[model samples]
Target: MTNAEHISEIATLDNVVSPDKVRLLQLLQTQKAAFLAEPYPSYRSRIDDLKRLKAAILASKETLLSALEKDFHYRSHDESLLGDIFSSLSSIDYATKHLRQWMKPQKRHVGVVFQPAKAEVLYQPRGVVGIISPWNYPVFLTIGPLVAAIAAGNRAMIKVSEFTPHTNTVLRHLLGEVFSQDKVCVVHGETDVAQAFSSLPFDHLLFTGSTQVGRHVMKAASENLVSVTLELGGKSPVIIDNNISLDAAVSRFIYGKTMNAGQTCVAPDYIYCPKNRVDELVDAIKTRYLAMYPSIDGCNKRTRVINHRQYTRLQGYLEEASNLGANVIPLGDVASDETSCFMPLTLITGADQSMAVMREEIFGPILPIVAYDNIEQVIASINENSRPLGLYIQSHDKAFQNKVLRETHAGGVCINDAAFHVVVDDLPFGGIGESGMGSYHGVEGFRTFSHAKSLFKRGRICFSDMLFPPYGKKIHDLFYRFFIR
Candidate 1:
């Protein structure tokens, strides 16, 4: 079927949005009340919840893939399964396995001055978390945070991207089958609805999208004093050491940049290649992409840009870069088919920051290559941009990897690899500066959604009365003499 036909098949699914602002507010209020009713869910209950979620996701796998295909025009089932479906299931399993320990109160040591008192930290759920997910990986982004919230025993209301309404519809049905609206609600809406969602009072808000929109979400959340976890995107870069083989680097790098047609947030936005090996690197990328898919046509592996708006935006980047005399090389045997909104993997060599492709996050199948003479120059250039979500070092030299890891700042780092750290489940995934703020995955995710409440109890032997006086006395003097120094 053609991409447009697939979109037309699911066109009716887009109408599943909340009717008005009142309904959106009502959903939040309902979730808040539900959270208040069951403020702390037991470990066993949370495990059961996670199990049910996992099962439902598995059952709805095909439906979700179809909806995503309709939404993106040509996303492969494997892409959705690996990134959204299986990844979400993995998160649920990880959370389920650890919830027992995560829910336990941690004992803390008391100071000598504060002796005879017991202290512990209780993980309390932050009520009514708001999850604003993006279109790029809608299911995983929404469900990922929801997993953390559920693990922490918090209710959540999700505001999904309008660009993926078909997927939103599938999610709404799936989550609704497992949870009441009060516990977990999927909210789909337009711009005004999104504005209202961002403005609502939430205990915590987690937004995943561009840095520009994150600023707005943060600002709107500030009015309610809502603590936020902003998973924003930036220009993530890869540095290939001069000592490394270009083929080895290409093998590791191509997987990340081409996966999901390079519509990944942590996809290598740009690469730092050895100055003498730029052409070789470009050829390696093209050869590797073709090896993955011989031709864009007839192969179902290709994914299209979400819509006309994004297609136009990405096209403008290529157009502007080409106009500036940059070499815009399109890989594969076939040229991009605009009718399907499909753009083949293209590389922009000798691209500087003057081009929009380099300046902005290229959330498409476009990579810009920066040839570097020295490692320090690459580090300096990366520093000039805002911190990225992920930094990749495609080098075997431990010293080189350590130097880059020690000096550069990013949300996460993958040595001799790229972008796969997000699926590790145990590790915390997030960004720094423009990339994002705060992380959520496994134990870190559980903690992000939970409030660590400190509990202290006094022992029977209370000696504080002796030191309570209007002025300094013998007991106060004794206390001061023993501890003041």
Candidate 2:
């Protein structure tokens, strides 16, 4: 079926969102507000709900894997189970274990001037949230935010990507089996329906996708002035300093770049290495790729581009690089058939900033090498473009790593690793500037969907009478002593 037809089929599954479901969500929000008013539910309850979600996912693992494989013809079952299923399940477990302390009201000290008043931060759910997930890593992208929204005690509407119709259908079915549609409803539609979905004045909206589309989603939400958390993509860089262990650096670098066929937001789009060490890193990466996927021609674990559209797009970048005098090195042998399911793992060297491969995000099994003579030049080059979602550095030297960390302004950084930074539940995951805005995951995720209301309880002291009179020396002195310190 055509993409549009598939989207229409899914949207027609349930012609209209039931009014009863909407009312149920409203009632849940009211109940949550009441619960917040009184003694809040112990963190244990929130954690338990996460546990339930995890159990539901685990029970449906096989079903989900099959659906995803069918959706993306070349998706690796093992890769899906590990990258998407395992990571999301682990995140849920982590959030469940740590959610109690995260939900507690944090006390903020009132200044000496406001002696009698006590101030504290009360985190309250922002009614209902809308989560719009992308096709890449469909399982994690959908459930990860749902875990946080549930933990924050907010009702959520999840919009599954239309590109992956099989996965979206399976997800809607699985979620329906696990929870009431009112609490968490999974909607599937095309770009137009998605545009309509974003226009809804949700309490908060969390969107994970490309930077260009993220802007449009934000604009749609602007009509409602709805708060948004965007996890967008950019040309995330991996910098290899001269002082690191080449062996470890190469392994992590290739592993990250090739995982999921480079369809990751945090994938190292390109690398900036010293001119002297450029050849060494390149050779190491090539050697590692051969060893890992011995026969890339029919490697089951090596995923393919999702569809012809993506394949064509990536092919265009490769063609542009070649036409622009960039050296395109095909690391693995391409299958005999030009339109075969597998595309060869590629690495381009002697690539300049002007080349399409280096200028745009190559979301495929392609890595570009850009050599730099000076560290300062590399840093300046990175800073010149839009801030990326992630910046990875491989340097055993503490000082050099610190310099990159401090100098670069990315959404997140990993000292000696690549995409693993997002695995940490405590740290926030999102982008900055053109990459994205706002963050989510763990406590940050909860906060993204919540309003941190500041509550102050003041006793009736009537000390302001001293300032009621017109400006005078005595009144000024009283004001200075009582308020201005």
**Top model by lDDT, which number?**
1
Q: Write the per-residue lDDT of candidate 1 for residues 1-485, one digit (tens) a residue.
A: 53234323333343444456557666776676677678888888788888999999999999999999999988988889899998999999888888889899999998978778889999999988999999989899989999999989888999999999899999999999999889998888888888878877788999999999999999988976889999988999999998888888899978898888788999999999989999999888888888888863454567788888888899999999999989999988777777788888899887887899988899998998998899999888888879999999999999999999988999999988899999999999999998999999999999999999999989789776777767678888888899999
Q: Give the Å error, residue 125, model 1.
A: 0.8
Counting clashing residue pairs in each candidate, in order, gives: 0, 0
List pairs with backbone clashes in candidate 1: none
Write the residue-wise lDDT of candidate 2 on 1-485 in tens digits: 63234333434454575444344334334433443453333466667667878888888899899888887776888889878899899889878777777788889998766567889899887766889999889999999999888888777788889889988887888787776655677876777667777766577899999988999999988976888988999999999887777778988777778788888999999988888988788788878888888873455566777887888888888888898888888775544123544676788888887887887878787888888887899899999999998899888888888888888899999878898888888888989999899998888888887789899878877354555767785868866887666
Each model's TM-score, in the order given?
A: 0.94, 0.89
Q: Best by TM-score, which number? A: 1
lDDT of each: 0.87, 0.79
Q: Which stretches of candidate 2 lie over 4 Å from their true place?
A: 1-45, 334-340, 460-476, 481-485
